[model samples]
Target: MAILEVGGLTKHFDIRPGLLGRLLSGKRRQTIKAVDGVSFTLEEGTILGLAGESGCGKSTTCMMIAKLHEPTAGTIRFKGRDIAGLDRAGLRDYRLAVQLIFQDPYESLNPRFTVFDLVAEGPRALGIWSREETARRVLEALSLVGLKPEEYKDRFPHQMSGGERQRVGIACALILEPELVIADEPLSMLDVSIRAGILDLLRDLSARLNFSCIYVSHDLSILSNISERLLVMYLGMAMEIGPTDRVVRNPQHPYARALVEAVPVPDPRYKRPIPAIRGEIARPIDPPPGCRFAARCPQAMDACRRDPAPAMREVGPGHFAACHLLDMDAPDSGTAARAL
Candidate 1:
């Protein structure tokens, strides 16, 4: 079942130049479309990996889903209710159902607070139980994430390693027992040896805990391993979304292909024919109309220059993508849905 659904979700960030900041001060200003027309669903106990470049609106989209940043426009429906319009009290309730694990463990954790304090904070905020009960739950939470109370309870953020701090962050969020967990690049900051362990821990925890997850990362390879489905975002727009393995193995969208190609081959015994994606990624502020990736896309066509493509289409069963070159028919509903 779809535990969380986001539709027509768009967020705009006001990027004011110094002189322009003064001129547009106290006035409606030009905006950066951080997350424009992104729509997707997270099924119960499943992982939906959102892969994109840094500043490609992945984090912005994650923030909106976490309700940390409100959408400038669009609907966020969770458990079939439009919680997007919920009030403060309603939002307070929303927190018990949806929790976010941030990317930077060092920054997300408070250096002054002990591990026990950090883990117990959410249950405290939500009035889950008495001090004694919350303390018990906190220790249990730490154990679930592989950190024992005796080992980590009194330790502060600075005393812990990067991986251990991140585990502590995960413990804090999981203690809430939220129905949906938005893990925003949780393993990106850790060392290579520990990255897989953390990913495995998150996957195991979600299955046992049964909280659907939205894992946001710039690494497509990580998404492929952990997710059942994946959404590819470029310049604040979804380029493709489909079953995880199909999209990663045989990508239809140029941007999706670029991402897969950009993944480094591990074995020295194997020589990869794929080349590194050339040119710099473009900014999201006032992105071009047609295809946002056309500037760097090797297969750019006249149609791509003329107008933007449509929503993801099924090239195979449950394997959909948004690209004009893959289409044989002219513009029609068959090609793409109207832009959200």
Candidate 2:
């Protein structure tokens, strides 16, 4: 069974009126559909990469999963229990079981806290562990993330490098022995040289500890390297989802194809024109009906602009894509032809 199942997960931020504006228009309000109708299942002990451009709702989805943002619609099932309806004690358990690693370690970590305090915060809050047990767990977690407690425990956040701080963040997240970890661009702020080490640490720890992860990022190359499966999002909606290797090599949706083509090739000598995705990303506030990516999709049809949101369709074994072009009996375009 899947460890985490997110079905029709949606988060909409209300754009409320200011005092004068509210007085002018009594109860009127608009909404920013940050995440819309996203659904996926995450298996135990596996990493699912959520990849898209900025404002595509990757981070928003992660926040919703971590319960930092409440969902306007949909259900989040962790271990077959709906998290949305969790009571006080259940919510506390949920918080301890599902940890979030923020994008910037420098900003996320408290300047006042030492490494040991930072790592011990969760366990101490739960009040389930004695002082000795908390210390042992903190030490174990630090070691798991390649940070020695003796060397780093007493150091303040300011004393550590970006990489070390990120490791500290990882250690803190793992100290609770969470069943699922939601990492929101955890490697984006680090130096290029340090990213690989963090990625390796995450992958190795997941393997050894048997925990699932939702790795959110805009970097397709990094996701391809670290995630077993990839969930591609465009303007708050899932464009495609499948095995990372398959999605990278055989992207079915135009947006997914564009994302794959955008990955930077390291070789300076290899010169090829990268496929350009034309047009600006659609605004999230009160977005238009129909497919959110339709306006920018090269393969979009007349039906795509008029139809209600397209449903996910199986394009290959374990590979699914949301595109009007994938509908049965739909005419094959040059883009869809190439995708097949």
Candidate 3:
């Protein structure tokens, strides 16, 4: 079943001129297209990895899904119901079902609170469970994340290790028994040795609890390990999306290919060629109508810059890429391009 569906999701931050600039430009306002026309679906109990470099709007997309940022356009549907149309009570229900895990564990947790208090905060705030039940669940959540309740429940954020603090953060999210968990670069700050354990724990917990997850990261290597499906983004648009193995091994979009090639090979004897991505990232402020990656795409053609951004076209079964090259695969290529 599709647990969450996001279609044509967009967020544009308007840059209104200050007094001096307004006097010069006369009410001119520029818009930053943080996210534009991003679409994807998340299946129940599956992990979908959202990957891109910094400022590609992957984090912004997650934030919009979590309702932290108001989308300028598009629809966010959860369990087949449009979230934008949800009533206050309905929105509250949605919040309980969807939980967000922040990237920085130490900053996310309250330094004054103990592990038990931190884990119990959500349930207490919402009054979801009785006092006894909340306490029991808090302990269980902590234990599930590998923090023994007897040993660590009373420890403050300052007392725990980085890995342990992250475990607490996970516990805080899991305590809600959420249907979907959005983890935004959760392992980015952790040590190499400790990251594997956290990933293993997440996989184990997902299997045991049967919850869907959207794991966002800039590193394709990390996503390759944890996600079942990979969605690659560039300049606030989806460049490619498919099964993890398929996307990692056979990326269709030029941007996605660059990202796959950039992942380091660990073998001592193995040597990988440097990725050929050229040119700097394009500015998001009032960007041109053409493909956002056209400036950097090595395979740039005249049509690529002349035409508007290409819509996602199916290049293979269950694999999609947004590129002018994929138009040949479409039966109604002209119509598809016109639709965009």
Task: Give the number of the best model, judged by lDDT.
Answer: 3
Full-model lDDT for every candidate? 0.85, 0.88, 0.89
TM-score computed on alpha carbons, candidate 3? 0.93
Instruction: Arrange candidates by lDDT, descending.
Output: 3, 2, 1
TM-score of each predicted structure versus truth: 0.92, 0.92, 0.93
Tell me the deviation in Å of residue 127 in model 1: 1.8
Poorest lDDT segment (10 consecutive residues) of candidate 1: 331-340
lDDT of 1: 0.85
Off by over 4 Å in 2: 17-28, 328-340
The true-structure Cα RMSD of candidate 1 reads: 3.6
Model 1 alpha-carbon drift over 4 Å, by segment: 19-29, 329-340
Q: Could you tell which candidate, 2 or 3, scores higher by TM-score?
A: 3
- Clash count per candidate: 1, 0, 0
Model 1, C-alpha of 115: deviation from truth (Å): 0.4
| Number of the predicted model whose TM-score against the real structure is largest | 3
Candidate 3 stretches greater than 4 Å from native: 17-28, 328-340
Which residue pairs come into collision in candidate 3?
none
TM-score, prediction 2 = 0.92
